[model samples]
Target: MLAQRAQLPDGRWHFQHGPMDIVIGAHGSPASVDAAHAAAWQRFTGILDELVQELVALRRPVQGDCPVLGPIARRMWQACQPFQRSFITPMAAVAGAVAQELVACYERSGVTRAWINNGGDIALHLEPSQSVRIGLYADIARLGLDEIRDGILTDGQFDVSSVLPVRGVATSGWRGRSFSLGIADSVTVLARTASEADAAATVIANAVDLDDERILRRPACELKDDTDLGYLLVTVDVPPLEPDRVQQALRAGLKRAQTLRAAGLIWSAALVCQNQIVTTGDPATKKLENRRAHQQLGSVFA
Candidate 1:
C-alpha cells in the first residue's frame, strides 16, 4: 500500500503506510515547520518498502553480526543488540527507530522542538534551552473514545529539558499493540533514543511475570503467523489479580528496569499492573536508591 498523509485540525500531521501509523507535532516558525513536514513526508514514503526488502533479517534474533542493511533497519538491530542475551529481535525497536528517523527532519534551525509518536512510542527533538512535558497513561485497557474526545486524564507527567539525556519514550504491556510475555498492565521507558527505549521496554515488560493458573497464555505463532517470537508463550488473558500479586509482578519488572538503567541502556522507567505502579526511581539516573525523594518525577499511578 502507498503512504498517505493528512493534516489534523490541531496543526499536527498524520502519516500512515501499511502497519506504520504516526502522528507528528512541532513548534517552530511557519516556514521551518512547513519545510520539516515536507521532508518528513518524503522520508516516510519509502520506509515501508525499505523494511520489506530486509524483513527476513529484521525478524531474526539479534546476535552475532548485524544482518540488516537499511539505515532504519540497522538502527533497530543496534538498539536490540544490548539485549541479545535474551530472546529479542530487531522488530522490538522498529516503531521507535522509524519515529526517530522522521524526527531528524525537524532538528534544523528555527525549529525549537518536535515530536513523532508512532502509535504509543515517541521520539523527540529539542534545541538548546528547549524542553517538553510528557503526560503518562499507565493503562492501555482503560483507554476509550471518551478519553480521547475529552483529552486523556494523564496518570502522571514529567518534564524533559535539553540538558537531560532523554529524548525517547515507549510503553509495552500485554494489552498493547505488540504481544507481551508478561502480565504487566504497562511498562513505560525513557531513554536517549526512541529505539533504545522501545527495546528496553520490551525487555522489562517480559520480566513482569508470575506463575498463576488464572493467567492464560498461547504460542505467539498461533496468534500472528509472522511473529518473531516463534513458539514462545505470550500472555493472552490475565484475570484480576490480588493486590499482593500485582506488587510481586511489578517488583520483578522493576528489577529489570534497574539493571537496564545501571547499564546505561535506559534512563528511567515506570511500570504498572492492576493500578499499582513502580518506577526506576530517578529520571536523571542519579540517586536511584532514594525513590521517595523523587522531585523530578511525579506519581505515575495517579
Candidate 2:
C-alpha cells in the first residue's frame, strides 16, 4: 500500500531487506531479476546502521580520506570527494551514490529493465517500450493560495486516477518526510534514473524558497538529528505569500529546473507550491485531473 516498488528478496550476500522506502527492478527471468535484487539488498542491508554508527566520523572535518569499512560508506566518501575540495561530507551525496552503485550492479549483471530506488531517489535501466510516470507534490500542500480562492487546491492527499506508464516517481519539499531548505510544498521530478531525479529534486527544492521573511525557516539539524543542510533551518511555515511572491518563488524553482534539465541531469520537473503547479514533462498540469478523480483512475506508473 505504501507508494513504492521493491522486490521481496530471499537470497543473501548482505544489505537487502525491509520495505526500504525504495526498490530496484529489472525485466528478465524471475530468477535473474530475483538474483539481481538479492545482490542489491545484500549490498544495502545494514548500511543505515553502519552509517549512523559512523555519523560522528562522517561529520568530522576530514582533510583526506576517511576510508570506512562499509562499501556504501566508501561510495559515499567518493561521491562527496569531489566536493571535499570545499567542505561537503560524504553523506551529502550518499543517497545518490548508493542509488548509482546499485544501478551499476544491475547493469553489470546484464539486466535490461532495471532500477535501484532509495526511499524516493532512484536509478533506472529501462528497456524499449518501458516508461515511468512520476507525481509532483505541491510544496504548500497546506498553503491555500488562489487554489482556495479559485477552489482548486483542496485540503486532501493528491489522487491519481487510473494507472499510467511511469515506473519512477519522487517528491521533495519542506513539508515532506525528508528535509528541504526552501519553501516549496512539494517538488516532484521524473527522469531516466532515480539518482538523477533525486539529485535534481534536491537542487530544485532548494530553489523554492522565499529569500525574505516571506516564510519562516530554521537550521536543518534543528528539525532532524543529522541533516545534510547543517545550519539552514528546514523551512518551517509560510505566513502568507502575496500572489506575486508565490509566483516569484515558483519561478525561481522553474528557472533552476531549466538549468538542471539543460545540463542533461533531469528529464523534467514538476514544482508544486500551494496551488500553483508548474511542470516540464509528460505529466503536465493539464493532464492531471483533480485528486479524488485521479485516484479512481489509478495514476501510478509502477
Candidate 3:
C-alpha cells in the first residue's frame, strides 16, 4: 500500500496514520490549527483506496485520454508527463503528490503559514518570518531509481529547509525507502513546491550513476504486488565501486543536476558521497545547519 499519513496537534499533539506520514503544527488561533487538522484529515481519508484505484488504471501505458479521478493521481500523472515517453509511471512521484495536496488543504484555508510534511517530502506555506528545519537523510536515490545510472551515491544524514518561496524537499538514493537507479545513498533537492521538488529529485536521482551491468536490478512489479512501475526494473543492490568509478558516478548525477538547475527546474541541491560534499547553485531559501556550531556549543546549551 502507499504511505500517506497525517496528524494535528494542540499541546504538542503528535499524529500519525496511513501512507501520509506528517508531523505538522501551526502558530495562530486554535481555530486555525483545528481547521488545518480537519483539512488534513479530509484530504487523508480514503487516499490509499483512491491511489490503489489509480494504480490499477496506470498498470499499462496511457492508451488514450485517461480520466483524472484522483487528486494525487492527477498530480502524479502531471509530474511524469514531461518524461512520460521516457518510461515513467505516476506512482514514482506519489509521495510528493500527496505532500503537495495535503499542503494545499491548509493553503485553501486562511492559514498565515503552514506546513504539510509527508514523510520527508514537505509542502509549506510560510507567512513572513517563518521557516522549517528539514532533516536530510543519508541517501539521495530515495527520490527514485535511476535506471540509466550504473551505481549508487550517498551522504551523511543532515538537515535543510525549503522556506518561504521554497516549499518542496525530496531525496533519492538506492538506500532509501524507495528503490534507486544509482547506488547513491541519498540525493536531496528543494524547490518551489513539494511536487516540483519531488519530480526534480526523481530526475536527478536517475542521473546519479553510470549505466553498467555490475549493479543488480529487478523489475518494480517483482518487488511488490501493486507497484506503479509495472515491469520497470527498480534499483535493488550494488557491488563495490572503485575510487574512479565513484567519481564518475557522482559526476554523472551532478552534470544532470546542472542542466536541471539551469533550466530552472530546481533552486538548490546538496550532493554527497562517502565523505565528499558538492553543493551546486544556491541552496534556496535556507542553507545547511552548521555542525561545528553544535559541537562548539556547550552541552548545557541547546
Candidate 4:
C-alpha cells in the first residue's frame, strides 16, 4: 500500500510512495494554494506505479534508442541524455524529475511561488517580484554543535530571487541517500530544472574523486540490492587527507563543474570536501557564504 498523504504541522504537504518522498509548499491566494495541493495530490498517486513499470529500463545506462514510456520516466531519460557518453542512468535524475513533475502540477494553479522538494532535489516556481531563501550546507559533518543539537544547519542560505535564471537545486555526496563514487562531503548544483540539477550533481560529485588508499569503497549493489550502478564502486568512508590532497580533489571536481557551466548545463555549483568549499558558475552564487554569518540558521533541505 502507498503511504498516506499528510499535512504537517509546518503546513507542508507530505507524500510518500515506496522510495519516493516529497514535500510541497506554495504561497498564493488561499484558494489557489488549495487547488494546487489538490492537483499535486491527484497527480502523485500513480507516479510510483508508472515508474515501477519501467524500472528495468530506467536502471540501465542511457544509450541510443533507449525506451522509456512514462512521462516522468521520459523526463528522467531526457535529463540524463546529455551525459549519455558518460556512465549515467535515468535513475540519476529520478528525484529531480519527480520534483519537477509536481511543480508542474502546481504551476497551472497560478501560485505566486511554489516549490516541490523530492528528497532534496527541488523544483521551484517564482513569479515576478518574488523570491525565496534556501539553505545550503557545505559539509553536513562540519555543522556546529548547536546545529547538530537542533538537528539542522541554519547557516547557509541563498536568496533565489526572481531575476535569477535558477529554478532547480540538488545536492549529492558520499553521505547522502544515493551512492556516490567520489569523496566529496557534499556537492550542490543549481540549474534550469530539478532534473538537470540532479544529473549535474551526480556527475560533478562523481568527478570529485582521488586515488587515495584512505578512501573506502564497495560495489553499489552490495549496499543496495537494486542500485542502478550495478558493480560500480561507491564510496563508503573517507579518512583524513592532507590539505594539498584535499585541494587536488576539489580542483578536479571544480574543473568538471566549470565545464558543465560553460556547456549551459548548470547555473552554478558548490563543491565541498573536508570543510573546504569551491564554487563554479555565476559570481552571485558565492553569496551563499555570507548567509553563514547568522547564528539562527537552520538545516539545509538536503
Best candidate according to lDDT: 1
lDDT of 4 by residue, 129-153 (tens): 8787777655555567886667775
Q: Higher-TM-score candidate among 2 and 4?
A: 4
The candidate that wins on TM-score is 1
Show where candidate 4 strays beyond 4 Å.
Answer: 141-151, 289-302
TM-score of each: 0.93, 0.66, 0.76, 0.92
The local distance difference test score of each candidate is 0.85, 0.56, 0.61, 0.83
On the 0 to 100 scale, the lDDT of residue 25 in model 4 is: 86
Candidate 4 weakest ten by summed lDDT: 293-302
Local accuracy of candidate 3 as per-residue lDDT tens digits, 189-272: 777767777777777777777777888889877898766566767778767667687667778878877777788777776654
lDDT of 1 by residue, 185-219 (tens): 77878999999999999999999999999999999
| TM-score, candidate number 3 | 0.76
Question: Over the stretch 173-198, how does candidate 2's per-residue lDDT look in tens digits?
Answer: 77756667777776766544444455
Model 4 earns a TM-score of 0.92
In order of TM-score, best first, we have: 1, 4, 3, 2
- Winner of 3 and 4 under lDDT: 4
